[model samples]
Target: MTDSSVDYGAVFKALVAPLLVMTPDFVILAASDSYLKVMGRGQADLLGQDFFAVFPPNPNDPDAIEDYLRASLERVVATGERDFMAVQRYDLEATGRQGVFEDRYWSAINTPVLGPDGEVELIIHRVDEVTDLVQQLGRSGERGVTGARAELETMRTDVYVRARQLLDVNERLKQTTSALQEALDRQRRFVFDASHDLRNPITGLLTELEVALSEPDSDLHPVLRKSLRDAERLNDIVADLLELARLDTATPTTTEPVDLAHLVMDELERRTLTATVLTRLDKQVVVCASRIRLARLLGNLLANAERHTTTTIEIIVTTDPPNAVLEVIDDGPGIAPADRERVFERLFRLDDARRQDPGGSGLGLPIAREIAQAYGGHLYAADHSTGARFVLRLPFAA
Candidate 1:
């Protein structure tokens, strides 16, 4: 070729993809400008070099570049068809600008070129730079699944730690509640026991003083009698306090049928007071309750009415289908509207005009209420036409 033609060939070679023409024995025939740049060498340095001599085959690995090249040539010659490759990778020498010496895999294609005589004249090699793609795939495969597994482990540990903290807080709350309940129970028992122990001594002293005040010839007899009466009232107050404390401490025992009408009649007969006592009781109104507790409940209400009323104390006992009601109506000055609920509280006395009336410890209604509730009943005060009406309601026996 002329010098002008050769110059044109070199210009064309630089424009093409990395191209190489190889001999049948795998000897280098000619290389393009792009091929020379990949090998990190000049055109003069690669001229006439044996392809396998420059790129040695790894004997321990059978599917090397040299083996692939021989197989392609053999297949093409035997079948009389042009052997072509879609894409592959070839390791090339590193240049100073390449930064490091590493095995570089380049995507490439190889095809057997045929002459007019139908003989395989040369093998054309075309390549592209694909080292970045290969390296990226390798990194993703190495770290993909491991990162996900680490994230899952961290989530599981967080859940377990939070659950343990919640359980610990719950256990502490349970212990605190138990301690508070025990303290309240102990305080209740202490009040009951102390009050019970004081009653006997007070009772004996009042009895002796009453006997001494009965003598008519004594000089200071009237004053002594007044003092004795005051002491007896104080003793009654202490007795009421003791009963209230015991009610607070005591839990309910067995419950059975109680005759409501008989309980009220018995309490009235026991008092034997001359103040007119009236009763209207249902003959067979039975309630499920502790018998002693029910009697005490009725007795407290009757005594309260007797203490407050001037002349007439009326008791009415009635029964409905599901419940029984015992109402004590006293013709005393009625309780104020605002003081109704407060009257059922311990030591809470109404400040009506009848506050001057005598002989009440002010705990009777509260004790009656506690007893009623222990038997699954309720007690309250309702408005009456000209008096105070206290009502006790109990669930009827099944």
Candidate 2:
């Protein structure tokens, strides 16, 4: 229809969403019927009134937004441009089932309507309710923090998946370009896993025999009992090897807030450690971590300290923003500066007469570090006066 024949009020009212048209002087010209219904305003009261007059800025708005709409509209009229407002809480009077007045979130855009002489004649107001996304974000704070963040991750994950698919094409074209060291690493991982898998049954056998020995008058062989103890130790080495192998193919770890102090205290209780242990754990410190792996990681540190030190052991848990740190300190000879890197090597053994009594298979540090790295953490050795100090650092869970 021609502009002269068209009923702008009828057309705007027929729209489903809340929208309005206002003259350059900010006088409300027309509003959608739905807009009035949603806003709990009568057309008679709104028409010919300032747009802000009908729905004033909420007194409780944190942004002090009373002047925001007015200022934005002025800018749009002057520049003949479109103004978009960020998602914000804007309290509005209830319409139908809604209460008298409730705080609601909305995204709004103000567009200037120009006249035939290229002067601003009117403003078109379009608003969208975003209360649902805001509520969802508040409830599931761990998910992409906000609605926009959650949506962003979904988009990123899709792009990442597609990019990963491109690797197949690259593989065919760059078959010879594949890194040889990666292939060697894979081969090494396979050997370690294979050996551990084969050794697990021997550990199981020793455990059963130990159980049999527990029963008095069972006439279990003395030689077999000794062998069982040795087998048990070997089983430990194999278990660590298996853990290292698992690290070679670590999966994305799903984490929840874990009480660092509680986990460590519980582990200490289970072991009933003989050494004089001192703990300086902050009860409030927590980390995003896999519960099972967190326990295992702490347990390994305790075991290593206890095995090497005859004196006191100190356990300290602290937080460094973005990371939660657990330190295990013992009163024994500390690691040599040169051997730092070698200690984390799978199946590596320390060369020290004082540290050799445990006769461990050298996989403890490797496995411990493996678990740490799997969860985007780091395990490192540091020199301590009395003995060795090992530090574990993991990211703070959101």
TM-score of 2: 0.48
TM-score of candidate 1 relative to the true fold: 0.49
RMSD of 2: 23.1
Residues 159-235 of candidate 2: C-alpha lDDT, one tens digit per residue: 43453344334334433434565688867775775566446556666676767768867666864766666777676
Candidate 2's C-alpha runs over 4 A off are 1-178, 182-220, 252-254, 353-359
Clashes of each: 0, 2
Q: Candidate 2 — which pairs collide? A: 332-386, 332-387
Residue 168 CA error for candidate 1 (Å)? 12
The models' CA-based lDDT, in order, is 0.69, 0.74
Please write out the lDDT profile of model 1 over residues 284-335, one tens digit for every residue.
Answer: 8989888877877887877777766879989899987689999999987777
By lDDT, who's the top model here?
Answer: 2
Question: What stretches of model 1 exceed 4 Å from their correct place?
Answer: 1-224, 252-254, 357-359
TM-score against native, each model: 0.49, 0.48
Task: Report per-prediction Cα RMSD to one decimal.
Answer: 35.1, 23.1
